[model samples]
Target chain A: MSGVKQRVPQIILTVVALLLIASAFVARPEGGSAPLGPRLLAIADQEFATWFSILAVFAFLMGGLNLVATHLAKIRERGPDRFYSLVTLVSFLVVLVIGTAKLGGPPGLQGDVTAPGSWLTAVFDAVLSPLHATLYSLLAFYIASASYRAFRARSLESSLLLGSALVVLLGRIPAGRHLTAWIPEPLAFLRVEELSLWILRVPNTAGQRALMIGIALGVIALAVRMIAGVEKDPRSGGDGS
Target chain B: MSGWFAPGTWNIALVGAFVCAVIVFSVIRSRRGAMVAVRPLPPLLALDRAVADAVAGGRPVYFVAGSQDLDNMQTVAALAVLRPLARKVAEAGGRLFVPTNRSLVMDNAREICRRAYLDAGRADLWRDDWVAYISDDHLGFVARVDGLIARERPGLCVLMGFFASESLLLAEGGHHVGAVQIAGTASAVQLPFLVASCDHVLLGEELFAAGASLEGDAARLGSLRGQDLCKLAAAACLVAGSLVATLADVTGAQPWLFLRDAFLNVFRAG
Candidate 1:
């Protein structure tokens, strides 16, 4: 574990050096206009981006290692949920080996890991994809349950929330139009569909845009803080986790 | 060698200037601890009361840190938020239940909770049983989370993170359990479910801004101001673009074309 951890700092320093060097030379200049330093930096940045992506891959491997260690320890200790640990480890190793080994090689060794008609592909498509989709779809049921309890018409704000929810909900459905169809063309602006559009487009969009502005600022601040290496941590500053 | 005016060189220079200005602005602002104006949610207070009740009622505070791994900005912001929240929960003598979808997230959540408890002077309240790592299988995580919400019947459920479809599910379950549900996520796609279900929904960037807003740290607030400046720049560009278009419409001079070209120059390919 220490051996594995040692590589991270080295990698970080290498990446910083690469980025700094590359920042000098940018990318291909229009009209063959790039100066030597900028051109070199641009090229370096491209190479850096290409190579640095591997860090994510390594992190994934690290995740797998952590998973293996934890689960194995769980199984050994006969922990309260040892069976689940075994299940996690089995699933992880199965995915790892199959994905990497390209079991059956799909259409022989030359094929991509996820090539169509392959076992790996099948497992992912049949198992992983639907599994992900199913988990994602759970939101639908959750929304229904959460909304029923939270959206009670208790007070003014709650009532307003209910009203907005209704507008947004009705606007998303055809029934909004079915009910509001009697309104004349001139007065159609008051229709649920139109109102929904206004709510999403005006207030929602405006609000989203405003938040984006704030987020961008926060990111900049975070980046600056990280670069300057501020040691403050809300948690005990050890590890800054 | 191409002169500084060469399109590529000029664009880089412009970007450099922009970056430098932002950096300078942020550096200065971070040093001057400033408070940002944040809209207080009266409903959020109601939410706190509801959560307190749930805890008093012997239910847990079910918190989901979204499905994202730690690297995501939304996740980091979520962690920042969880600090204060975990503190508040501990201070209230409530049990905080965090069921994470990712193993790394699970570890981080535990560390965060540990720190929070320590900070709140209730380190003893922290327990391994509280922060559990469910399966990474997204659906499995949701099912397990859903089950916990049902079984534990937490007094308050807070789901904050970079969620996808699971946002609706988690919030809904919390609501069903009669927990005070306050949810926040930066993912626009999941906002509908959250907006519909959660008692207090922090919209879009507010999720990021709220952490800084709540902390009232000058550096964070300055960053907020920097973002405002960035937005101003964007708005200025939009207004300028519109004005040029309007003038071009009247004068038949196509002023917008030049403005567009200028904008492109700023954003032009390397």
Candidate 2:
């Protein structure tokens, strides 16, 4: 893999990737509102996309191999953290064997490894599903704790936070209308539900959108850096020696 | 028949104007020897060094690729940091432990680590166990990762990615362990917790750019530049739109709806 032959393949692959990427953006799609160039680009884009997707699959395979090799070596070295390696290998092999042997399931279109009564389904439902539920469930406790801590009335911002939270929390609850029912028709704007709606639509949504915009900008900057290859991965920046 | 700018042209023009203004300002500043200097990579390197040292001293470096699939930009950012982090650990002979809630992420992390190690010529040191997949259950994953941290007692822990309430529990646990922690997330909800507990917190865009900042890749830089350009354009449009709407409201003219529709159409096209 370190020889000149490897370099040749790498170079070829790089060239192919560059050309495809270029084509995807440069050529135009046909018979649309877009220009001829753009139409050509669209056709080229589909072809490039398909090829790129296949390449990604290969990348995934390469990654899987690396994963297996890394763990296998750990087991062989009997490293102090070897138990971790053991667990990893066990999990990988169990899934791999189950998938290949189609264990606990009947075959389907592509050999339904995921068919009912299959170990895959069992693992997914019993192991994976429960795990997801449990992790998601933690949000309840975390949200409560965070709310208590964040809702403290320390400053103007804190007051706003507490106020908004109260409005929303109360509005959603059955107790809100009962509490606000005494308000006159003209003052009905003070209803908890209406207040909550206003807060969400005006303040909460506005803040969320602003944050989203900032995030979008940041992502663009980062993408430019990567595309320019100026932001080399530190690992690759090391001396080849 | 409409030119590129058309009614939507104002936004692009505004961005162009801003850039021109900045360049002119920068030139003037440079001539006066008052040019602002920027060093973007040092903080990331320092953080990496801190993470590496912690991992090197027989303590694992805890890393989570957020609660997202690798496709998410935040997840990619986490992996970018992980690449250097894993190498530093490999070089220092320390372990890098990444417990992923997403199976695909485990795959991505493994690839990134392997590439890092191979780049370092210490591919032999990279282990699959280094990036393990726990339960996909968010809380289950959190519990398992937390347990791993408790048992491993890593010197440094980094929680970066799209997070929610689970982020708090993880950060709090890291705090309890007395590990030096660095956290980054786009989720504003989790930012306070990370800031409260982690030694360093990458907020919002900082999290998005952390990966690109770690590397001085021109492509990534260009993307950042493009994004900034887009943002400038957006801001200009925002101001213009607001003014137009206000003016239209004050007078009998109704240009505001046209501008709004134009903006909406442009955004929809994008």
Candidate 3:
């Protein structure tokens, strides 16, 4: 009895997953030509997708509560990072109030929260956008630092990578094309641009495709394990049987 | 037939079923005591070491589940790895912090961590705040996590899952903090950044295999074996198809062309 009770939830999960998969693959003919089964499956798929979206919205709400609780605890503790937590809380509340109330919009709750000149819109454009852009700008410096480390000719592989990087970098510029312009038409493939293109189109593409195929197979296997209930359920909090 | 399968998807359905059958069969066989072996993944070993070191040194271990939501397959695989690692950390009395950008992922991660601690018989050590949602905004999450990494200076940073442009910032942040970083993701675009910045990297499908490799259990190993078999079959098909297509193109042979088209139609959607 205990085992059966434990298996109940897993059975339900598996059934729902199988239903979703079947609905996704099964065909639905157009208009009245569609059979009842396929048509029902299509409707079930749409309903399930909608249900998932609704659940996601609820999850978002739960996350907001979690964020508030966490920052509030930090503030209560008077830790060194309490000030930042306070700022986060205040900003969250301000945005939530502004967006929900549709403040600074045309008027009334019917006005769009993100309408021009709205408080939320101003906050997004003036504060959030700039902050996002500033963080994004840091990527340039990070890339430079990463490249410096990656391009060091410490090993054969690194040397090859460095050589390829140099070719790809130079081939993208007009100077590289000019340098190779003197080459005969019969030897045009030896030009920097041609070589770079070949390197990208051939070896690079092949490697990426191989990786993609491997990843795809991995995904399929993992999905099978999950659907078959062979994998451990993290929510159960116990080691696998 | 068209009415029984979605247009342009019958081939996909057939392939999906075949893959599923292969994986399921392998799993059942292994469960019945069939032997399965997987190649060693160095990053998983490094991860174990990092956890032990953190426990001994009384420092925190940071786990970043990347910027993707739980819906992503990569996030599922990342969470799978987190289960054993979290349990190990909890058992050894080491602090593990997981900062997530997506709310759903954060919730799922918290459950996983909580379960880990419970299984370790150290439920008291589990804290809901350990897996916190920073922000859904990409850069905002990165900035906050970067600050956290700098301030905490964790001994180990385990970055696993799907990441985008912020991959380097996070990895470099760990590097600057002198943390032993182990990063894994299937994102081709970000692999280079991770390879450059982390101590150990799991490239592409290796991320998916990490959990199974760490677990070393029959079912998981069998699944891994199943994936390998599928990969071999795919390679064989690719080679055969290429040969047939090339012969048809070079020789303008009607028989070769027919054979190639028949083979292609078996795999081609619609």
Candidate 4:
């Protein structure tokens, strides 16, 4: 009975999927009211997708609870990371309360959570915005470090990759174009700008297309497996019979 | 307004039906003791070894799903990979920690882990908190994953799904922690970054197949083979279309032009 019950959700999900797949063929009007089947399909797809968002929004409450629980447990245990957990819990509560109560509303406009000159915007502008920027800026340093490691010419392939990367990088900038201005039109394709475009449109695009096609097929296969009841777990297909 | 079929998507529907039919037929054949050949994926093979080693050493394995909501296919693909991975961990008597950026992904990961543990007959080893939602902010999620890598020092990091600019950041963070990193994504721009930084990468469709291929189900494997046939047909179409287009351009030939248009119309026509 328990096993049968466990399969119930999966079964329903599969049935819904099959219906959607079938309904996708139904023709819908472009500028006017669609036929019943097509209209129903469109509505179903929209409703299902929206339900995912709604569920996720409700799941946010669970996340908050989990965060609080995890941090509180850490504090209770007095682990070495207890200080961090304490800080996290305290900050989380502060933000939750402030955001929930609309405490940042203007003095005369207490109802508007996002009122102009509100503390929420102030905190966002003065604190979180800068923090977001700081984290984004860290990417520059990381890219440089990663590039340095990747560009090391330790092998034939590595050397080719490094050389190609240098050409592409140089070709993209104005300085590289200026340096190649003296080159003749007959050899214009060898110029940095032309070479960069060729690499991007030709080899790069070719490789990307191969990957894209493979991924498309794989996703299709996954869907097929799901519909066939081979993939039982609607989330991950973890259970194999 | 009276029609039931979508005029614009008729071709797509037909293709989908054909593919689904092929998959179903393949599944039936597979169940009848027919052998289905699947090519070996080096990264997935390495994944098996890494999980076993990490478990034997009593080190935790971290699963980082893509930083996207349920709207993204990459997140779903990542969930697929988690199923087998969680089971592997449960069977090995090790812990699997999953930190997701989206609430839905967190729930999905938690359910996946629970199912894996239950399937392995070690449901007691699974913890409700094993999967946690870190943040919805993309960069914020990456920052949290970086912190987790630094603190937990997981023996292995499987970064799979749809990733963007933060792909290298996460891979590099795992690299800095000396963890064996296996990453996969369908993002063309991020593929090179992951390939360069991670120990192994499931390029493109490989990520999607990674999860499907985990259990070696005949239906899944057969569908994979069917997809290969579709790919070949697509490749042939591309080559033929390009040839006809080039001939028309070079010769000003009306026949080649008509052929090219006809071929394109099949795919693009409503």
Best by DockQ: 3
User: What is the overall TM-score of model 2 with all chains considered together?
Assistant: 0.70
lDDT of 4 at A180: 85
Write the residue-wise lDDT of candidate 3 on A1-241 in tens digits: 7568658877977887888888878876589887888888888888888988998899889889989999999999999999999999999999999888888897775677788999999999999999988888888988998899989999999999999989888789999889889999999999999999988999999999999999999888877777788777655555552
Candidate DockQ scores, in order: 0.27, 0.28, 0.76, 0.59
Given candidate 3, what's the lDDT at residue A24?
A: 75
**What lDDT score is found at residue A122 in candidate 1?**
84
Every candidate's lDDT: 0.69, 0.67, 0.88, 0.79
**Model 1 lDDT at residue A11:** 59
Model 3 agreement with the true structure over B1-270: per-residue lDDT tens digits: 448677777678888888888888889899999999888998887777888987798889999888888778899899989998898899998899999988999988998898889889999988889999999887888999999999989999999999999899899899888899999999999999999989899989998888888878899899999888889998999999999999999999999999998888887855
User: Cα lDDT of model 1 overall?
Assistant: 0.69
Chain A vs. true chain A, TM-score per model, equals: 0.78, 0.72, 0.94, 0.88
Task: Give each model a TM-score.
Answer: 0.71, 0.70, 0.96, 0.91
Cα displacement (angstroms), candidate 3, residue A151, comes to: 1.4
Q: Top model by TM-score, which number?
A: 3
In TM-score terms, candidate 3 sits at: 0.96
lDDT of 2 by residue, A127-152 (tens): 87776777667656665665676677
**What are the TM values for chain B, all candidates?**
0.85, 0.77, 0.94, 0.90
lDDT of 1 at B66: 85
Q: Which tens-of-lDDT digit does each residue in A90-148 have in candidate 1? A: 88778778877787665456778877766798887888788778677655566566577
